[model samples]
Target: MRSIAFLSADFLANPWPEYARFRAERPVWWADEIRMFCVFRHKDIRTCLTSTDYTVEYPFRVSRQVFGETLLDLDGPRHQRLRRPLAGLLLGQRDNIGFRAAAEDRARTAVAALRPDTELDMVRGPARTVPLTATATFLGIPPERHDWLLHTVEYLVSHLDGSSGDFARASALRAELEEYLLRLISTGAPARSMLGEVHSWVRDGRITAAEAVGLATLTLAAGFETSTGLISNALHCLARHPGHAAGAASDTGRLRSFLKETLRWEPPQHDTVRFARRDTTLAGVPVPAGSALKLVLASGNRDAEVFDHAEEFRPDRSTHGSLTFGHGSHSCLGTHIALDVAEAFIGALLARFPGLRAVDDPMPPITGSTFRRPQALRMWLGPKGES
Candidate 1:
């Protein structure tokens, strides 16, 4: 870790230069400090993400240890069963209108918190809470646990770049979260909540108590954190390119393009960690069995072969098959959810404060390497003349 630039302040701030270097030189480089292989090129990253030769378990048991063997730690039929609930929700759940309306309404409510004629930080306001409450409601978690749940899961995922003490803290937080999920399962949640469906699965033996708990925790954490990142990134993008603001907030077609570009440009979910299931090779570099690897989706998203002017944010340039969320079996299930949440929140914000614009030109180059987002989305929320 000492020699690796990955944990350095500079790298966390701007890793693209180094990522580009890796893609050109050592496409499949190994980090001896952590004994993990990093796949940099978009092509190789695609294989690692889509191929069946990697597992999130084994060398990456931290996920299992913390989240208690959720779908992320499973494979094949087992993983499929646990994924059914989220996939169902993503597929509309036969109640698409109701679910989408609830999420949009929650988004509007979150944005409505900001005052009309003042400066504000979107990160602290709607960017965080919109997804937090929306995920909680969808999961059927009580409002009492929403705030606590957000911080707890934030710690859990943020520990990837922390010390052993940080890991210990994450473990402790995981215990508390696990306890909450289990208790809620034992008692009840709303019948329409995703948690309720998972709870029913536990009741009917479709999944075990432990699996159910893991499923719920993963749902809550992934749903909220991923959505928050996309929302913040979208807001940051909106601030940078004010010309697209009207379209992103008002027009669905333009809004989708803006988000697709945002996801490709500065995707919230950066990388996916995995372990080699068997001896293999990525970009001609040997990967022995049990080798820990990081499929850097952030780098893959910028591969010039796939995206023209990969470094720039061009809304007109389609980002159709980009590796924004992830690839393959364990890919994120919240794509539509994140986009919808961002659209709703951004739309509501502009509706409330019509002249909202960035106080700083670029909104502080999105901080954090693991879960990237603008530290503070400072904006003048008043009309142009008032501001």
Candidate 2:
């Protein structure tokens, strides 16, 4: 009982050792307090993700009062219907070429803005810079409004940190997001952007106004942090491994490997929970219906049975594939966009600044928060052409 309480409170504080123990002792252990079964094994993680027996609860019911119903929480045809407009908006065939170019172009612009011989927080500068403009391009928000949009999202998302389960903060954010979406919709800008299309879809009776607001808010919430964390994690890796960074800088061919390894080393989305819709067996354990299951993706990625030297950050490791973007029907919709931004930013930074290293005070430490990310990354921007 005491151990379980400790796991609940400090799971984020020192998860690696706990994960290792769970992997060896009880790969599919149940936590009575949270009433959720956790998967720490490589195979169990893969199986839980790949199997259709489980269901995800985005704005999870307890959370729905705050987030409302979006595709993140839906299943079956309802989810399919809700995703159609977003599919065309976020992942359509026609949208892919343009969005990719637009994202990369925005990344190039951010890189150009970096000041030589000046140390800075990549999170505020390039990290926020890349996603802010890219999301604006996708949603048709003007670039000048980037700061406000980011600020709003930042405040709201900050609520989601280790303490977001609070009712007051969640309600406030949800109310503000609702009003913002309503105002944006009332402007009647049905052009080439997602907001416009969502408005048009709502007008056509494809989705309700509430649904549109929920989905839009979901997109806004998920857009920045994912990209930001990935870049931070990559920089954390590159700064520590100059050799790997240097090699990848010379040949962009190693970009994919670096990205894969960084994901394994420090995955952005650490865990995803699913509500057990019905009693089912997972990894040889019986899970009762309505029970919650938390899949520790970071732990799964580092499972010793799955990868050799699972704890070490090895760019050359071949089993670098991961469910960090999730798996099955609930897989992240922005995967390609995320990769493009991460690869472009990391690849460009390494190529441009060869002497980048973590600044001592705000150094990138593995945070204890469930979302495994560096809270801040301060890199020393050395004079060019010197080690």
Candidate 3:
């Protein structure tokens, strides 16, 4: 027994190996330092994620050091009530087709702008640009404000490691965002777009001003980052497995399988945290109420018991679904939209640049947070036959 942290680098860089080891020995082990039960097996993870006894601690007292107490931290009825209007905005079928198509168009335009033989930063290019542009455009935010919004999201995400200065900065940004929303609400901005619709929700009391800002900020913060990561990670996976990419590029069936397998292989949110709502037992291990449990979603996705040759990225492989987006009532609201954007981006990229290859200099640095992603990914592009 090593008696060290379970899912540290030994796991993040190549989790399947560690998960196989842990799931075989201590599927449910308590981290004394973190004061929570760490579960690595697929079945145990699924049980914890889907269980009502566990709850998302809002404003994540710990994560508030970075993300603040937003909807991501809320739970139960309050979380549901707060999420209703936003859910309506994201899930409503009213104009979803138009919006979805518009998003794809925006992605296509971004892809078309790529210059030949250039090392494009996926984070700054299509990954960050497409979603931010599409979401901001949909919300009717002024084109000029996109830069400031992206900067804000970048600064906020940087503060995730409990930096005091970062929190102070995020606090200021949060206030500025709230004030901005309040003024928009006070002036009764004409309902010009979805962002305006969010203000309308506030004005009509469907959501509070704070809630509205949180929703908006969350949209800005989470929307682009995760959506971009999904495409980038999927591409990285395919590039590593040329056969899988080729398979998916030719067949929609293969594409669907690729999506599932990619998610299982490298989910955006590598781990999800929870502060137990009350004393609870997870698969027989006792977790004290309020203890922070790190459910290794990425680790769980590759559990050998649930997924054969879990370490391998095989698009055609069949098995239970991954908990990438999450499970239970508090699952991601924008998951479908995220999937849509990802599929569109990958679909377009493969169709346009079948010879896409990763750049030696721009391979993104693997991160060490609950969310697993490269800091940036740059790829070499060439004519169809060049690579």
Candidate 4:
């Protein structure tokens, strides 16, 4: 058995093979580079997400270190207090005339902006733009400030890969965001959006103004990566399996299954970390309390023990327990909206454009260790059979 340098250039560039090897040989390996126990099996990864022995909140969680005491950095009651009401409001907007319509409108606008005659980078065009714009709409951000929101999220996410200048830029960005969001909060609630809800929280004294800013920032940054990844990833899946393209576009059921398979095969948020609440054992390896464990969700999604013939991309495969979205309490709050965005955008792309495909057969490779997505997907959008 070989030791896994989980963050090595080789692994980060392409990790599927290492994930398979690690799951088979050392399901509970300790990664010396990051100084944490890496859990590769499906069950163990699920435990890291859902079990009482492990918690997403602790002094050492990376998110906490990055964004400080934001809503994403909280645990249990405090987390729920801020999230539950907001989640309820968000859910209410899930219906057609509400949140779903907002998502659809944003997605359609993004799709309509694409010019098929010339090559277009889908990731830069629709993938990133739709989510950020949709999120701005949802948060009631003003039209003038939309560009700031997009650029800020770009840097906020870039910090995860330790990109140069991102940390300092993040600091400056956070201060600017504080001023902007606080002003938004002061202007009073707008309709029934996330920003409005946070404003009410500040007014009601349920949370401080600074806490409200943290919460807004978290929500903005959170939805950006997930939806962007899903859109681009779904496109890649359809392109790779051209046989399934027309059928999925015409049929809603096929499209849903297609998205499900894409989520499992190439999840955007590849891995996440959890800290032990108490002394716990994962895959028979002892893990002391407070020890950090890296849950390889991408690996778990492909665990053969969990999903039969998992290595292959079977669009029809049952993806019931897939960890494409993190499981349990920490599951994505914007999941419903994200799905709406993907279905609308992908649906529009297929139905209106007909045979949509990558300009190149392979497309750009999915990149990033944390938020895995094609940085660029230059596409040729035309009638069926053009590609």
Candidate 5:
């Protein structure tokens, strides 16, 4: 392993320029700070993602603490078994009319509550509420428990980012969340919900009760946070390019492309880690067993070899796909649900507030190293008559 200096704080705040440099100079290099081999190029990252030699079993200390042993930390048949039932339910939910309509209704209601001609924090308004509501509704979380669920999810996500100062509080919250889920399962409330489905799997001896808790925790936390980031990031992108927002408002195809471009340009979760199970060569660099590879999905999305004008956010740009939601076995199961959430929220926002514009001149800073999104999107809602 080749050791190098730690990445600077500024690079973590805004990493694209640094990523460009790495792509040009050393696309694959070892950083001592994180103790992981960082892969920058698209092809190499894709290769690492699909390769059987690399597994997602790298020690994600915070995730393990908060979520227990989830599918994210498993590999081989064990991972497949845990993922199968949940994946089937999620895939089926994607095409369910009731689920989609409920999501749209939630998005519409959230956006409609914002008064025109007033500045609003998009994060606090639609971005945060829509996904939380949608996920809870789909998971069959009771209305009374929605507030608790949201708060717990936020707390869990903070720990998942691995930078939270209050680990003790996060640990307490994780315990509380687990207990709450166990009770919810026992009560048999929302018996037809995903949690109920998971409980059924447990009864059938497919997985343990603890595994069910973990899967439920994973669904509640992962489902909401990433979806929240996607909505917030997409809004930030649209605010920066008003013309695209206008085009997207009237054209469904353009709106879909706009969301795709946002995913490519500023993916919510920046990178994911994988552990080398055996000796391997990545981009011709020798990787030893038990080494961690930080697959920079954000960098791969902007690789010059794969994308033209890689730095610019052009909604109309043609593309095959981006690594935003990852690839292969560990690809996001909620990809379709996330896209649906974005479509519903963006469509509702554009319809309700025709001339939405960013209130901050430069806009709020996008933050986080492991996870990235606008801290808060302050936007001015144009008068009802304005277009």
Candidate 6:
């Protein structure tokens, strides 16, 4: 079997084949170039994520310098203390009927604005707009401030995959965003929003003012890019299999199954890095303390032993709860909201344009090593009045 380099551009473009080979031969191997142990199989990846020995703290110098110490860097009680309030808000928002209604309305408005028989980059149009609008709504920001929120979130996400020069600009943007959040908090909360809840936390002295800013930053950044990527990916899947679009619009159950399969087949966040808190063994391979381990989540989603005919994208296939959003203590807090936003946007798109289909053969390829999605998804919206 050929040795796999995780950082190779070729692997980034199409990693499934290489991941298959690795899962078959070497499920766990150390890559000298990157200096991180790569964990590939589904079972092992689950263990790596849930095991008490590993941590999500930044092991690399660059990430630590860039992101600073946020919730991702904490462990034990501190991690729970920081995470609980935010998790409560997110869960409440997801369960709130008012929030869901507003999200669906925004999604419909976004879809209705699109013109038919014209080439449209779905990523920029509905895919991007819907999530931004929903996030702004979640924060209780007025329409006038939506642009600022969008730009701030976009700048922060760009830095996640930025160069050295970009880091300086990103740092400036981070400061500005934190200040903006602080200002928003000063004005008082909107009666029915997450920002309001966070503001109350700050006032009660439960969380410091600085922690409030950090929590807001994490909420916006986490919800923005991942939600956008999931929407774009789901739409791309529907376009590839145009036959499914109609069923998705008419049947809620079928639509959900399609979305779940999409999550397993092409998750937005591909891989996550973790550090060994102490000298430990993973899959019987000894890893020294402070060493970095790259958990290939996309690879785990395709582990043949877990899913029957995993390589193929079958909407009806049973995923058995894939590790796309992760598991255990560090699992994503926004999983329910993310799925809701994606469902609303995709459902609106299908209902609005039942005959939607890809404009180009093979379409655009999904990219990015850390967060993955189509670079551009161009599709035709059938005729003017056919919907």
- Winner by lDDT: 5
Query: In model 3, how large is the Cα lDDT of residue 271?
Result: 72
Supply candidate 2's per-residue lDDT for 362.
Answer: 40
Write the residue-wise lDDT of candidate 3 on 1-387 in tens digits.
644454466645655566667777888888786666778888887777778777776454555545456787777788888887677777755553245675787788877777666667675568777777777666666667778877776667656533346466678886776676556555644465666777667778777777766777677667776776777778778767777788888776688678777777878777777767788887678888777777878878887777788888777888466778777776777776777677777777777777778886435555556666676777877664321
**CA-lDDT, candidates in order:** 0.78, 0.73, 0.71, 0.80, 0.82, 0.80
**TM-score (C-alpha) between model 2 and the true structure:** 0.88
Clashes of each: 0, 0, 3, 1, 0, 0
Q: Cα RMSD to native, each candidate?
A: 2.8, 3.1, 3.0, 2.5, 2.4, 2.1
Residue 75: error of model 2 in Å?
1.0
lDDT by residue (tens digit), candidate 6, 1-387: 577765678887899998888888889889887788999999988988888888887645454455555776677898899898787777764354255666787887887888876779888777777888887788777788888878767866776653435777778877887787887776755867777777778888888888887777777777788789889889888877767766787887889888888889999988877888899987788999988888999999998889988998998888775889888888888887788888887777777777778888988878777888988998888764444
- The residue-by-residue lDDT of candidate 4 on 135-253, one tens digit each, is 78888887677787898888777776545665666778777877888898878548466777777778899988887887777778877888889999889878888888777987988
TM-score of 3: 0.88
- Misplaced by over 4 Å in model 3 are 4-12, 58-60, 96-98, 161-165, 184-192, 318-320, 361-365, 384-387
Estimate candidate 1's alpha-carbon lDDT, on a 0 to 1 scale: 0.78
TM-score against truth, every candidate: 0.92, 0.88, 0.88, 0.93, 0.93, 0.94
lDDT of 2: 0.73
Better of 3 and 4 by TM-score: 4
Model 5 clash pairs are: none
Worst 10 residues of 5 by lDDT: 1-10
- The Cα RMSD in angstroms, rounded to one decimal, for candidate 3 relative to the true structure is 3.0
Q: What is the lDDT for 349 in model 4? A: 79
Question: How big is the positional error of residue 112 in model 4, measured in Å on the Cα after superposition?
Answer: 1.9
Candidate 4 clashing pairs? 93-99
